[model samples]
Structures are given as C-alpha cells and as structure tokens.
Target: MKVKLYMATKSAKQQASIIGLLFAIVCFMSCQRSSNNLGVTENMEKDKTDVAEKIVLTDEEWKRRLTPEQYRILRQKGTERAFTNEMKHLGKGSFVCAGCESELFVSDTKYDSGCGWPSFYDTVDKNNITQELDSSFSMKRIEVLCSRCGGHLGHIFNDGPQPTGLRYCINGGAIKFQKDDEDNK
Candidate 1:
C-alpha cells in the first residue's frame, strides 16, 4: 500500500512538471511573434524633422488648443464612445492631428471597420506616425501615435483589407477633417 502511495505522488509531481513545461513553451513561442505589423522597429529612430519639429505643450496649453473631447483622446490617451464621431461620414478630406494640425490620414483610406471608431488602412505618410507596444487593460496591442506631437491616435491591428492588412483604429476626436477642393466642388 505504501509503495502504491509513493508511486501516485511521483506521478503527480511528473504531471505538474509537464504542465509547467507546456506553459513556458507557450509563453516563449508567443514572445517570438512580432507584435508590430507596420515594420516599425522596436528601436527605430524618429526622423530628424520629426524630432526637431515635435510639438510639445503643457497640459494647460493643450487644453487651450483642443476641444474637451480632443484633449481627452489626444493628450490623455482616452477613447471616445464607439460610433460617436460626427465626422465619420465626411467622405472626402484629409484628417489632421487635432493637437498639432499635422496631416495624419487621408479620407481615401477610410473604411467602415464596424469597430465603432474611424478605421484607416494606411496613413497619409509613414513618417507622420509612430508605434509602440501597448499592454494596457491586460491585452497586448500596437499603439499608433502622431509623430509630430507624440499624441495617442489609436491602436493598429493586423486585420484589414488588401494592399495593407493593417487597421489604424483611430479615435475621431483626435483628428479634424479638412475637405479637399474637389470634395468642396
């Protein structure tokens, strides 16, 4: 009976070790996967102009420049309620950074992602934006920021349409649309 009890204990220890090994393997494999899709390197240097011309403002200055909602999303990294942006249907303009008036996205890239916020497949210029690994709220995501002002625009995801399977899920409050002349006509 003692022998059987000892064998049972040994088997339990082996099971625990196997479970631990499996957990470690999963974590290691996940870490191997690249979190960024746009090829923004983990240590990529910002452009000289982007660095030199960056918009730096104090909280009071930002408050003065942006609307309350814009201040929340751009400066505070807060999110607007999904589908709440009035500019979603503007259809023909470039979206500029609310904080710095830097063009961040064009209307041509806009699409209905049904994620409740404005979604774009591409940016007006790659140099206008930057990305960072976001691990907030117990989830891992790629956070998109305005390179000119370092403001939080949104998060990018791998699921998107052809040409570039990346979704720049931006907050509308962080941007202002300027209608093109053709759109005005």
Candidate 2:
C-alpha cells in the first residue's frame, strides 16, 4: 500500500512540473510581444481630419474603381500572398488608397520588414488612417484602414523597428504608388 501511494505522488509531481514549464513558456512569449509594443499608441484616437473629405461610394462604384485584387483586399479584408507585390521595390513615392486615392504613406517610411508585404513605420498623415481591434481568425490584431474610404489597408503589428514600433503590413493591391516627380525624372 505504501508503494502505491509513493508512485501516485511521483506522478502528481511530474504533472505539476509539466504545467509549470508550460506556464513559463507562455509568459516568455507574452513578454516578447509586449516589449515590442513600446512606442506604439495604445489609444487609437481619431485624428482631427475633415470628415467632409470622406468618400462614400456605392458597392458598384467601388467595384468599378478598384481592381479585382484591390477589391478583394480593401473591401473584403483579404490578404495577399507575401513577397509577390511590386510595391516591395518601389522608391520615392506616395502610397494612396486604391479606393479613394487618399495619401496614406510616404516612401520614406517604407522599409523591408521581411514580412512579404509593404511595411511602413509611419504614415504621411496620421489623420489619413484608422485602426480597429480585429479579433478575427482566432487571433487579436489591429486592423488598419483608409479613413476616407474605409478600405482595409492591412494589419499593424507592434513588432516593428523603433520610432513607432509599428509594422503596417499592407496588401500591395490595396494601394497605388505615385512616383515622386524627382524619381520620375
């Protein structure tokens, strides 16, 4: 009877150790994520841009304005496959919303985040974009949108370089790049 009791205690101890190890791992990952969030704006306050400038279009009008791929990503919240977009190599330009042509990001803020999509550390104007808490796909994320047209540009992650620590993982199809005049020459 004593031998049986000893074995049961040993098994319980092993189970406790495993649980402890798992908890430690989860804590470590959470810390990593949170640390990267430094410099990111916690409160997504609306910028005092002119609401009158907002472009409200019918579904059919949007369909006509944007390409099919752009329509999918911007209007339907779809993601493009990584590293396949031409925007990755673009230089000296401004990225505008595909739906409303609103200036969103500048080429100076663009960086290669190795995330496949175009990553920007900042926007040309903070008032041009909006963010929402997206709890889709069993994960929590900040979804970035074009404030004027309400188009889904992409998701913004805290895991980015300094200054803002924001990686705007935008779908290439969701934006149109206008080359700077100097760049064109």
Candidate 3:
C-alpha cells in the first residue's frame, strides 16, 4: 500500500510502532531489484573474486615499504637466485606478509624442499593466498599470491619432500626474516 509520515501528535507507543513499521518497509524495499541488476552484480562479483588484487600501489609507496629486492620479487613476480633467502638459516618465527605485515606462514609450516626457495607444507590458512592458473610459460602452472594484499609470493606444486605432499615454493625476496622474540628468553 502507501506509507505516510505525519508531524501530528501521537502517543509514545504509537510513535514507536510507526518508526518500527517504517524500518520494516525500508528493509523490504531495499531487497527488491531488477533481474538485469542481479546479473550485472553477479558478473561484478565474479570478476572481483577472480583476480581483484589489492596490491595496487604508488611507486613511491611501494619503494618505501619494501626493499629493492622485495619490490622486484613481489610486484614483478621475479624469483630470487637460488640459495639467497635469509630463511635458509631455518630460524623459528612467523613468516609475515611482506606487503601488509600480516602473518601468512608459521614456523611449523616451514619446510626444506632443497629446491632453493623456502617451502611450506601448508599456509597459515586458506585466507592467506590466492591460487590461480598460470600459463605464461609454455607449461601450465599454479601461481600463488598473498590473499590479503595479493602480492606475488610463489607457486605450489604437488611434488614435495615431506609428510605433506604439497609444497608452497615462495619467493625468497617476497618474505621477511622475523625471528621469534621468545627465543631470547
């Protein structure tokens, strides 16, 4: 039907009822949408979830937040030379996000595959990385990225040396060395 708002005086209980009714009406109206709008929304959401990376940044901002090596590896997806990662020391600690400083790999997940890059048996959680099909090379492969900022981290392979058959061969320059502070005690 129709809704009307009046400035006329009314009892407190009536006024409260009117307010509640208006709220319900607003909620109902907001739920209505055209089919075309729904289709467009579905497409938009699909595109967003597919490859909407939040790693976009100004050149200056990127430079300030990362070292030259880190910037090159993360933004460019360039791999560091074999045997150059500081994590090679095998220190115990959280392997945090190189871009946003969020923890993506814990010390327990870290494992050595002897392929040169620091590999992980598992990520901190599924929210930690985005996996996508990569065919840039002649071969098809899976490229792994930071889920939070979408920074290029590395690749995951089914072949791994461990109890877990999966290996997350992350880019060395894409991670930072944060030794566990508790080790000092």
Best by TM-score: 2
Rank the models by TM-score, top first.
2, 1, 3
Ranking by lDDT: 2, 1, 3
lDDT (Cα, tens digit) per residue for candidate 3, span 1-185: 12223334345568899998996555323222121121211111111333353556787888898999888888777777656677865568788778867577887888777667778878776666777665554445567777767678877776654565667778778877677888656
Query: What C-alpha lDDT does candidate 3 achieve relative to the native structure?
Result: 0.67
- Please state the error at residue 71 of candidate 3 in Å: 1.0
Task: Pick out the ten consecutive residues of candidate 2 with the lowest summed lDDT.
Answer: 27-36
| lDDT by residue for model 1 (40-74), tens | 33444543454678989899999998889889999
Compute the lDDT of residue 83 as modeled in candidate 2: 64
- The runs of at least 3 residues in candidate 1 whose Cα sits more than 4 Å from the true structure, single-residue gaps closed, are 1-49
* Runs with alpha carbons beyond 4 Å of true place in candidate 3: 1-56, 161-163
User: How many angstroms is residue 3 displaced in model 1 relative to the true structure, after the best TM-score fit?
Assistant: 64
Give lDDT per model, in order.
0.79, 0.81, 0.67
Per-model TM-score versus the true fold: 0.74, 0.76, 0.66
Clashing pairs in 2: none
